[model samples]
Target: MGRQSIKFKRLTPFFNRQRLEQQFSFQLTATPKAIDKRFIYSGQVTERQIHKRYGVIVSESSETDDYVLDDSFLIWQGQQGLVIITGCSHSGIDAIIRHAKKITGNDKIQAIVGGLHLRCASLAALKERKSNRSPC
Candidate 1:
């Protein structure tokens, strides 16, 4: 298989709701933006680096340290590269897969599981067949 991408759940209507949480309505001809001004997508996280929740690192584009993670892989022994799981990826599943490959230094995706979050995904299934090329 080539690579896989899928979404696990549907986001609330207010998922994309943008509110002025902070006060930064200053003048800006060409000023830099902060992370809070963006929508962070924590794709289908499956691990728990801490001791609470099983993470589902979603991919996102931000100026902050890291609002989202492109890699949802779990390092078992070496590297499995099982699937590129994500949920409602605002940054796009394609972009997320690309980042995973780059970060893992591998082009093989085992499987994909999660929501693509495409405008038309509501009327379709995002499950895809991999090309049988897993990271070595």
Candidate 2:
């Protein structure tokens, strides 16, 4: 599947949450705009093997999409190589790695730390993944 575009209208509720919280006497800072493009990894990945069943509801109207385009991975460049920090990796680990490489223009991944989201994967799939591994 191709990358999907998210409309700004769908994000209005999230951006306006601070106003909603004010009614409850809770203080919250205004939501900041997204990071600049240069700091973000905007390319698509080759494989989206997992989290295919996941859906994202981006608006109050409950519109949903099968893919989570907002998912991200934190990459740190070090003297040794790149360290990737992720949360759940809803986009798939392989995809995250590929995107990280594309963004940094570096293929040397030093370490990967965080959730792989493989709990629901079948044993056969796990075995296949293990068998396909190559030394880094």
Candidate 3:
């Protein structure tokens, strides 16, 4: 066997404005990585119905359930029901599901994908994981 040189291809940023508009009108974007702030993209995807749903809330909670108010979600409506895609679900899954069904008028949850933050799992459940029945 002989050693060989590998060649790599340079990739360029490609954009077709017409094609993109046909699919999804660009929604609000938050580029900042800070937990305390959010910034929207300054592109021309001006649809009033979309932009009204996004922003930041600065209030804090006295309860232990307090979490970031910037937790947003993406809901897709299909023939069966709504498919919810969320980040850390700080507002709770039940609340999110309820809101989705109310907004879309679909009670059936076709699918839910993302972290549901089960920080309150019971001690027995945790112990079960230590047993052979459940692997780490």
| Residues forming the 10-long window of minimal summed lDDT in candidate 2 | 26-35
Residue pairs with backbone atoms closer than 3 Å in model 3 (clashes): none
True-vs-predicted CA distance for residue 113, candidate 2, Å: 0.8
Computed on alpha carbons, the lDDT of every model, listed in order, comes to 0.41, 0.64, 0.50
Candidate 3 wrong stretches, greater than 4 Å: 1-66, 123-136
lDDT of 3 by residue, 48-87 (tens): 2122223233334422222344456667666666677767
Assess candidate 2 and give its TM-score to the true structure: 0.57
Most accurate candidate by lDDT? 2
lDDT per residue (tens digit) for residues 1-136 in model 2: 6546566645465556678776665422222122353333334444555656465456656666657655666677766777777887887777787777776787887888899867888999888766654433
TM-score-superior candidate, 1 or 3 = 3
Please give the RMSD of candidate 2 to the true structure: 8.8
User: What lDDT, from 0 to 1, does candidate 1 have?
Assistant: 0.41
Q: Name model 1 segments beyond 4 Å from true.
A: 1-80, 118-136
Best by TM-score: 2
The residue-level lDDT of candidate 3 at 126 comes to 54
Sort the candidates on lDDT, descending order. 2, 3, 1
Give lDDT: candidate 1, residue 34.
26
